[model samples]
Target: MTMTNTAPAPTVWATLQANDAPALIDFLVNTFGFIKTAAYADGDQVAHAQLDWPEGGGIMLGSYKPDQEWSRRPGTAGMYVVTADPDALYAKVRAAGADIFRPITDQDYGNREFGVRDPEGNLWSFGHYRGEPHP
Candidate 1:
């Protein structure tokens, strides 16, 4: 006998940062069709927020820290997010105040991806992670 366990595939999620989280969340919701599912807030300050995307997808967002230097800096390393539509998402992100690093292009490694810089200077790279579906 043969058996299989099937589940909806999971995609890569990005842990991003924005100096102005309220504005960032507003831009994401209004422009990219993303919705805030949950958040950790302090009065008017958004400590961390979760924005859900399609395909059982989501991203975790936070504010910039003075001592945290690696993840949220412009010239430093950042997070890569895999989405179904990189071009469309890139456009939405760019229109919502992100700085486009490059046009959406099919990468040599078998992904159509693009990179953009968020308000707090973190680079958000959107692409399709070329791999087998999760079991």
Candidate 2:
């Protein structure tokens, strides 16, 4: 039997730790057009940052410090973002010199999507598919 909840879905957020948080912030903003909603820096390192998409959704980020237990391998998180216009976003990412991991294609799941790697090698994907509602 399938079980379903009627509660609203919780907002899901992702955080990435970059060696150069400030630079990463700039890169995300410049390349993906993410807006820095809030940022705190400790000198050259970004203590914490929150970047938001124009319509909705966002991600948290900070500088990677070996001292932190949460630090992961450099540039290893695979991220997916929803976009209103996958084609347009793909063009921007291409112009930004992103290394295309997967060229824009219509997925069997119905998403017109593409994937790329950021300057630090983190994988990111943008797609027009919004998954079907839970039953």
Candidate 3:
């Protein structure tokens, strides 16, 4: 017996906490080209925000409030994003003053990749690697 799936693969989403959400949003949009999808505020402070990538998927974020019951340390996330042009993205990220952790280079696994840190210090990596079973 054989089975066939018909639904599109679910997209993976990540969350980030920021010390200054508005500033972070500006950095993401201007430097990384992420589009602001939604942003909620509480008394002039961003309560929550959603930024979408043009290619697909996105990341959620919020300003950290010490009084909040649920909050994580800002700048403690490491994320990998797949892109069609790592070299071009790397150039943009570099020109935007992103702190590069690793220069763009080819991997033995057949990926061209680069790593950098966002303004808030979240580790971000971009690559052409699609991982396994993504053909």
Candidate 4:
């Protein structure tokens, strides 16, 4: 018998709201390497957007709307993204002049990681930790 290994597609997504959704999308794409998969908009307001990380998984975001029932405060979300190359990413982010709150460093758990604040004030942590295998 032969078996094929397959990684599952991401189902759960990290989501946030941005004051300037379009600019935030550009920053994430140019600075963090996120691919802009889709973005829905209404004039100056973005209704929704999907940005996929090159490695795996992705994030969803939209324009800030405090009056909406599902409204989320802009700049209040924090996310952790897994990456294979922290040093290279750190260099790119630094060159882009992003606000890095935590410098790239090796963790006691054997992962290399760094943290930054986006233009919208959201916190993002990137690391090499892939998490423990599922039981």
User: Of the candidates shown, which would achieve the greatest lDDT relative to the real structure?
Assistant: 4
How accurate locally, in lDDT, is each candidate? 0.70, 0.87, 0.86, 0.94
Q: In model 4, where is the ten-residue run with the lowest total lDDT?
A: 4-13
lDDT of 1: 0.70
| Cα lDDT of model 2 by residue, 41-115, tens digit | 879888889998875788999888888788876599998888999999899989888789999999987889999
How many angstroms is residue 57 displaced in model 3 relative to the true structure, after the best TM-score fit?
0.7
Ranking by TM-score: 4, 2, 3, 1
Q: Count the backbone clashes (under 3 Å) in each candidate.
A: 0, 0, 0, 0
* Tens-digit lDDT track of model 3 for 16-100: 8888899999998998888999999885588889998766678988998777777878989998888899989999999988899
Task: Give Cα distance to truth, residue 22, candidate 4, Å.
Answer: 0.6
Candidate 3 regions with alpha-carbon error over 4 angstroms: 1-11
Mind giving the per-residue lDDT tens digits that candidate 1 earns over 19-131? 67777777666765677898897855677798986545777776656576544632344756668877778777777666788778888878998887655555667787746
Clash count for candidate 1 is 0
lDDT by residue for model 4 (1-135), tens = 999648798999988888999999999999999999999999769999999998989999999989989889999888999999999999999999999999999999999999999999999999999999999
Error of 2 at 46 (Å): 0.7
Better of 1 and 3 by lDDT: 3
Q: What is the TM-score of each candidate against the true structure?
A: 0.65, 0.87, 0.86, 0.93
Cα shift from native, residue 31, model 2 (Å): 0.7
Candidate 1's error at 124, in angstroms? 1.1
Positional deviation of residue 16's Cα in model 3 after best superposition, in angstroms: 0.8
